[model samples]
Target: MPRHDHASLFIPPALTRRRLLGGALAAAAVGATPGASVFAQAAYPTRPVSLLVPFPPGSATDAIARALAPQVSKALGQQLVVENRPGAAGTMATGIVAQSKTPDGYQIAIAPATVFKVPHMQKVPYEPLKDLTYIMGFSGYTFALVVPESSPWKTFQEFIAYAKANPGKINVGTSGAASTGHAATMRLAQRTGADLNHIPFKGGSEVLQAFIGGHINAVLDGGWAQVEKQGKGRVLLAFTAKRMPRLPDVPTAIELGIQHVARSPIGLVGPKGMDPAVVKTIHDAFKGALSDPTYRRYLETYDLEDAYLSGADWYALAQKMWVDERKILEELDMLPK
Candidate 1:
């Protein structure tokens, strides 16, 4: 499936936390070999767990992690501290988790699309499918193309027209180079014949600061909901398959006949070789956290979809996404020579 497949994520029927935990126990019983560590098979997560956010503070992923940590901590009977380790377009912290000698459930990070996409673009420290244990996918973002309200372009078409006329003169901003927003903007340029110049920032807050200060003509990011609410900018295009309910007036890139659709699925992942019992404990805790009212409201705030998939299912999806994203980068000539 392409990156635009909003409904592609596998969501199973709801199951109670007890049932989920029971299933995990059964799996652990079957998967355990002779002489396996009794500690690994014992009641898991005996201490505080560290949830690392790859993006900087104030990022969407960071907010989601903070929202989920307390709820997960309550379920696991241990505190889940959210640590900010933002860099390398979200790959640095992920590498830290993947490279850890301990496969204990205490250290985990939020895996974004970049987790898989970056390896294909350039050398990375970890293999997406091999070095990490995918716990669960809780949410995915809805991205948009936002421009200052005072700008002359009133719609996506007008913006494209201006870009077409100006060529590389139209400066577009994203959270970072090769990020979901930057890739989507590049794909849109390919499909529309608009030579849009991409400007990368450290994070969404920085991107917004540059956009608001008129340093860039437009920004494609998930952090535009607040900006649009302040009436400082207008969302010209939603880089989603369907129009976002929060931005009903905004048209989607697909609606405008552009085949480019970008979404960044967020999930929890630990180091490779984690115990099945421990994986289940973390997954069940976060599964319970997914329904938290505050977290649900946070999802709505950014128009993010509730993309829940079990550990096994998310691992399979990541395998497929690795292949799919590689094709996208190859097509864009973004891969190294």
Candidate 2:
């Protein structure tokens, strides 16, 4: 993925707690009367904010978070620090954010769509929809089914047919159990009635490695833009509603007669019990950041599409995704015992 230039948006080291608090108090005093300003300086994020990525540092989610951090920090006039806390298929970091002491907008998480799928596969401490305040939905990357260019299966249908005939002989790679890749593979198996074997890795890079090393027959993973560009593999199909502009030749799952699309949409979120005012402030900042030209360029470079949504809209989508994921997991017999 392309790294966005953050020099222009870098937070000054001179930004101190005293200055931030003083600015907040002044804004509060000025806005003591109702209907003062939506961008009231005292509303929320009185200090540096931390955005947690529930995946390892170089993962797609982590890259997106880092790309948006400086822009968000500039928009909010506060430093946005990104912290990696990968474990338990993202539940561990999400659990930490859900249980954190700060709901004042100082702490937030970059939530992946996989968070909705994980609960069906294992015990999770937080409800995907109810335990967090959805601040904004920014961008999403499409999942791709990739195999070596020399593989015998040329198209998605061929791969499905081969898998059906071979049963558990064909192995597929995923980032982790309940990841978007994993859920998508399971759903594909259920839809096609193929008894394929799944091999889980810690991240997309590893999944690609397994596929290249011939340890896995195919990889159902994100970062297709990166993988396909490497020239060693070909994308069998995209698990998206439409063909990606960069990969125009690749067919989508829908185009291949499947009714599902599994892009890993990510967004900003805070722990439950956040003040509505704080949520609004954070949402506005991220919304602004999403529109920044630099950010837009980053999206295009990574073959990611912009899917901006407000807090309410994102929350509704999250709710629907949770329900839909549960149904799919149950149908595939992947629900936890």
- Report every candidate's CA lDDT: 0.78, 0.72
* Cα lDDT, model 2, residue 171: 92
User: Candidate 1 at 183: error in angstroms?
Assistant: 1.2
Highest TM-score, which number? 1
Number of the top-ranking candidate, with lDDT as the measure = 1
Residue 50 of model 2, lDDT score: 86
Candidate 1 C-alpha lDDT tens digits along 214-255: 999999987777678789889999888888777689898888
- Model 2 spans > 4 angstroms off: 1-46, 212-214
Whole-structure CA lDDT of model 2 = 0.72
Worst 10 residues of 2 by lDDT: 1-10
Per the 3 Å backbone cut-off, how many clashing residue pairs does candidate 2 have? 0
* Clashing residue pairs for model 1: none
Worst 10 residues of 1 by lDDT: 2-11
